[model samples]
Target: MPRLARPVPAVAAALSALALLVAGCGSNALAKQPPFPRSTIQANAADPSEKPITGSPTTGDPVDPAFAVDKLRLLDPCKLLDDDALKELGKPDDAVPGGFSRCSNFMKDKDGKDLSITVEVGQTVTSEIKKADKKIAGYRSYEQVLEGSACFVSVITQDEPGLAFTVQIGYKDGDGCVPGRKVAESVVALAKGKNASRTAAKGSVITVDPCALPSDAAVLEATDKSPRVYPYGLHNCSWVGDDAEMTLDFRGGFVPKDDKFDSKQTEIDLGGVKAYQVQTTTSFPSCTIKWVQLRGEDNDGEVVEVKSAGPKKAEFDRCAKAQSFAKALLPKLPRA
Candidate 1:
């Protein structure tokens, strides 16, 4: 499972409270919330193309490739949960961008209870899709409850077999799957119509595919041999070789500074941009390099991160490897 690289601040706070419930720390609060309900909806496994909705952008078209991964990278995930789409759910707060391909909307029900809805595009799905027992808005959908307070509803958007549009609902006061399924349907409907907004800024990292950033030779130099590639979501990619691994990640958040990760972090000059290098052996031998690629409003900005890791017994310096790869990769990134 791919974890969220950066969560919106408000959503993070909300999830933190829910995490306490999951940890069995809030029994008194848990008693006030309704029990998770059994789903009564039946599964529809029939081909959606067989019953195409009239005038639907994705139905009955021989080459309906609008939702392809490349196109999805350009569409804004924050726009998927617009007021018109989420009006039926509750009073929605402004949509906040979580990362390149993720956005979150926090809402309040009529009873003033909190609900969080997050939309993440281009998620890499594997065996998780096997649990998909329902189809929503002409797409295969999977619903799962998390810690009995949140629900995840993912719609398989690509037949290429790994991409999905996932909607997550955090509602501790009610059955989250019910709202989760409804939000998934709304997401599918809006996406099929091509109604989601697009990122307007030129040279934004969201337009760049992380998998295409580093050259094969560059990866080989870092990993010691031919490497296998793994793309995570739309903004992360990794190359694993026999003895080492390298990862590239693009995320949006406040600029990183020293003393942030509780490790030995040093500021280094990568070309002209100021970059931070953090080396840690908390788990294994690993080092990470990050630099702000574009400054956004306030303290938030776009960040380019590179990580290098190897076996603990390896004699090579991981920080040196991370810095070397970052220098080579930074020149290839799109500038603001």
Candidate 2:
């Protein structure tokens, strides 16, 4: 008993070193996991569904929240925001959403900036009711005053393959803020027709009144009587310009089914505008899932498809939006 095992100093030193190495790795293991199948906190926890019932600091905490925008996603979520990243700073509006609770999935540029800044404009003639998911559609924007400057950071969702904001990010000159959105709006206002920087969003599926026309159509109604422009999003549905009737796919994008699906456009003249209506049904089902069906009639799988006019078009993106909108619309439509 008096010996006290002092005979193995070398062994004791080796054991201590091994323990420190293990501890170091254990600390970072949570943050070091890959982002694909999506990392879950329950990986190490014994119970996957054992959610905390009360508000406690012991809730689902991430080893690392800023999981490099390239990896962490709200279409997926990373672990958690670091202690320093949470230091609330900037303007009153900068702290607008507080933690940007409505936002998920932080997507930034190469230099690390949030991009979810697209907002809806004008009043809707119809209710802002969701045609698809009942929840309001949008994301979060982060605003903060950094170094005496007003700055906003938003997390844009990857609704499609690329960025989701109608407004792009602007460069920082050590003063002022982003400029893409401003530039885009200006372009939209200046647009004669196809030249406008007017971008549209794909939203929940909603039925259109057979007697209704697009908002843009109302504008052209004062001018040409050939091609008509179909405005989308309630405010605008159809417009007549030269001798053509334009179908605004603004409410929906071109969703293709297969290569064999028709790639033609429906030409109509409203107020002589010379507009082309690219039907979603005319376009091939871009995705095997979310296939669009006839709005009312039991046309079965005989859904139509449509695509844009020119060569440079977003066929796939348009189809995706159509599919999503159709899926949302089917459940809400008056139903045949």
Candidate 3:
């Protein structure tokens, strides 16, 4: 049996809005910004003859995620499951290319409602098994039904210490976990290692773990109090001080935009990285800092914020507080 570790934190307010929107559970009107657009990038190179095939050619056969999770960096989810594999799931449609982290498809039931399947590659840890309900394919697995809305089956793969690739299914009726497990199993079977000979070394800015981004001392120096950690969400963790709250968000899907803010935007520097500062004074006093974490190929963004209100209003400049936290946290981000 594999060991179980702690679960990766849930999506913060920002990502929770995304999840809800994607799940068809709510309207996105109140979301901070529009969801990141789906990626249309395909994997094929024009001339197969020009480039040499590296690694064993993908057999599309099941390999244990414990051994192949790192290879997900290269696996295109749309191509991962072939047509025949989709057929087994009841007339599977074409896979919908999602954001960098997800792929999806759907089939209709007798009544014509859609039953959807989605695969996501994201931050996960082996210890998540501690919170799982059962074992599937030698890994700890979780089965959940969102009542009438959807069902989910998640497996903690042995990729990195805290990362897992997941398969989720949603339907209007019956046990959604039934199909969720089926899709989860197929995803496991599809997991394969890339050829070392042909695969080039690549790095990802999205892989940064939020929980590891700030030290206790840094949190203290920035907020002047002890911090609390909220592991599950868009922000890696939330630090709560006696008078202020801070959130560190690693935006894997959407970059920050100036148009999203009704307030003035200020540009600043954090550990040599260019960042923008926004102050929100309407609802309450708060500050938000957004910076580019990975540019060019990935075009990803990162954000940190500090907000104080109520009794502490007279003590600090919220924007300055946010900047101080951003400064303290910037040195900790990956520069390369």
Tens digits of lDDT, candidate 1, 43-115: 1122324321111111222224767666777767766776876777777765655566666666676576777
Taking the tens digit of each residue's C-alpha lDDT, what string does model 2 give over 1-336?
Answer: 000000101122322322222222122432111111001121111132432122111122322232111222111011122112222211111111101011111223333443222122211111111111211123322222233222223222221111211221222333323433342333223221233122211322222331132232332332234443332222123333332232222122222334122246444432322223344343232222222332221211212222222122323353333333233323433322
Superposed model 2: Cα runs more than 4 Å off = 1-181, 189-194, 197-210, 213-251, 254-336
List candidate 3 segments past 4 Å from native: 1-84, 91-100, 106-113, 121-131, 157-166, 191-204, 233-235, 256-264, 269-273, 281-285, 297-315
Best by lDDT: 1
lDDT of each: 0.65, 0.23, 0.49
Per-residue alpha-carbon lDDT of candidate 3 for residues 1-336, written as tens digits (9 for 90 to 100): 111111112343433423533353122222212223211111111132332211111222223533343355445555544556657656665455443445666555445556666666543333344457687766677765556656656776542233455665566666777867766766666654332112211333344545567667766765676654433221345566667666665544333344232246777776676677776665456777776555333323333333333233536676766677677766665564
TM-score of candidate 3 to 2 decimals: 0.61
- Between 1 and 3, whose lDDT is larger? 1
Order of models, best lDDT first: 1, 3, 2
Find the 10 residues in a row with the least total lDDT in model 3: 37-46
TM-score comparison, 1 vs 2, better candidate:
1
Best by TM-score: 1
TM per candidate: 0.78, 0.19, 0.61
Q: How well does model 2 score by local distance difference test? A: 0.23
